[model samples]
Target: MFLAIRELAHAKIRYALIGLIIVLIASLIFIISGLAKGLSADNASAIQNMKADYILMDTDAELEMTKSFISRTDLDNVLQMDGIEQANSLSVRMMNASVNGSDQNEDVALFVTDGDSMLLPSVRDGSPITQEDEAIVDASLQREGIEIGDRLVFGEESELTVVGFTDSQRYSHTPVVFVDGGGRETINAIAISVDESRADEIRNAVGNSFDMVTKDEALKGIPSYSQEQASLNMMIVFLFVITAFVLAAFFYVITLQKRDQFGVLKALGAKTTYLAQNLVGQVVLISIMCIGIAMGLTLGIAELLPEEMPFLLTADEMVQTSILILIVSIIGAFLSLIQIVKIDPIEAIEGAGK
Candidate 1:
């Protein structure tokens, strides 16, 4: 460790260049990861925030909530099934609504359910929906100047009154509007709360007509949610691989340049293990420093991003990315250790003398 620090200080520009590359790669990873998470929330926060453990959809719907329709009879049947703790009708619909004060019609995702359903989001402002025509809208709508007491005209005669506001409620990149179904005959699906142990029983009780999917499965059902996340995650994986290769090549070259120095140390009784530790220490120190700086840079850029941009960075993600980068850096540094161990003191000394 002492030798590693000394060498790094002695060759600050060379090490800084390597660190700069790491910072750029790490920052890109963090930013892309944030977009993946943010886009996920924007696409399916309505379902992600649901308290239900499982959703029962029409088997023929292929996991799509909009295509699935559960009759009132099936909902009752599931409610009476043993081990079924809670069941509520859920309907998702996309429609354009004419904002009361604006001439433009905004696309909104309708989340219709029983007024008393636990699936209803708690209000962040104003009162909860208590009437069939009353609705709680996602807070994102506020950016467009929509507010409580405003009316959203759905069709020629149908209108919904905004009664409350909810945070982080969205679907398919549109803000969610929670409305009371008012004893609607059929719904898109049934949101249920049940234990994993009893999932089989619930599935059997619902019969083959309906499919019970977990939260994750339901998220994939949202159009483009899966594809967007897959692409971003793939990019993150590639970045990690590239970081490893870049570090390995850089350190290996540096190791070769210091062949005589390592040879002299080996002649002075430096063990391979000690030299290996110094190499690993340098990699770790550089990785941590670069990752920390990248995190700070990424977060600062996130703040400056536009409100419409989907970007979210959680502490867990930061920690995970940092750890992964550190591990990959160490692995890359180990590649250079091969060159270190192969340094022949006699040969290296003779060459230096010549």
Candidate 2:
């Protein structure tokens, strides 16, 4: 550790340049990861936040809630099935709504469920819908100057009064408006809560007409959700690979330049293990410092971003990324150890003298 610190102080500019590269790469990874998380929430927070364990969709609907429809009889049958704890109708629709008769309209996702259904999201402000035509909207709609008590006109004659606001309730990148289904004869899907032990029995009882899937599976059924996540995840994987290669190349070159120094130390009784420790220590220190700076920088950038932009950086993700980067850096540093271990002290010393 002492040797590592001494060398870093001696070659401050060289190490600083390496640190800068790491900082830039790490910061970019963090920012992109934040965007990925934000997009996921923007795309399916509504479904993801559901208290239900499984969703029952019409098998013919191809897992898409928009295309699925279940008659009230089917819902009742499933509700009465053995091992079924709770079940509620879920209807999803995409429509344009004008606030308080405004000429302009905004796209919104309408989620129709029973007034007292478990599928109903608890509101952050105001009250949940208790009657037909009353609704609770996602808080994001507040950005468009919408507030509690504002009337949302759905079409030529249909209108709804916004009675409350819920947080983080979005679908397909649009804000959600939850309204009472008022015992509608048909529903888009069924959200159910059941124990894992009883899942298979429930599925069998419900029959082959409906497909039962977990919440995550249902999120994938959302339009473009799977593709978007796949693309972002690929980018993150590539960034990690790039970081590994960059660190390996940088440390390898630095190791080559320090051959004579390493030879002198070895001749003076420094063991390979001692020198290897110094190398690992330097890499770990540098990685930690750079990653810490990158995290702070990324957070600052997130603050400057527009509210409309999807960018969420969670502490868990930050920690996981940092740990992965650190491990990669250590592995990269090990690549340089091969050169150190192979250095012939006599040859290196003679060459330096010549």
Compare the candidates by TM-score and give the number of the best one: 1
RMSD of each: 1.2, 1.3
Instruction: Please write out the lDDT profile of model 2 over residues 1-354, one tens digit for every residue.
Output: 999999999999999999999999999999999999999999999999998999999998888999998999998888888788889999999999998998868899999998778988888999878789899999999999998999999877999999999999999999999999848898999999997898998888776789898889998789999999999999999999888899999999989988998999999999999999999999999999999999999999999999999888889989999999899889887789999999989998998999
Off-target runs (Cα >4 Å) in candidate 2 are none
For candidate 1, the 10 contiguous residues with the lowest summed lDDT are: 201-210
Model 1 TM-score relative to the real fold: 0.97
In angstroms, the error of model 2 at 232 is 1.4
Candidate 1 lDDT by residue in tens digits, 113-154: 998998999899999987999999999999988989999999
Runs with alpha carbons beyond 4 Å of true place in candidate 1:
none
Q: Residue pairs in steric clash, candidate 1?
A: none
The lDDT of each candidate is 0.92, 0.92
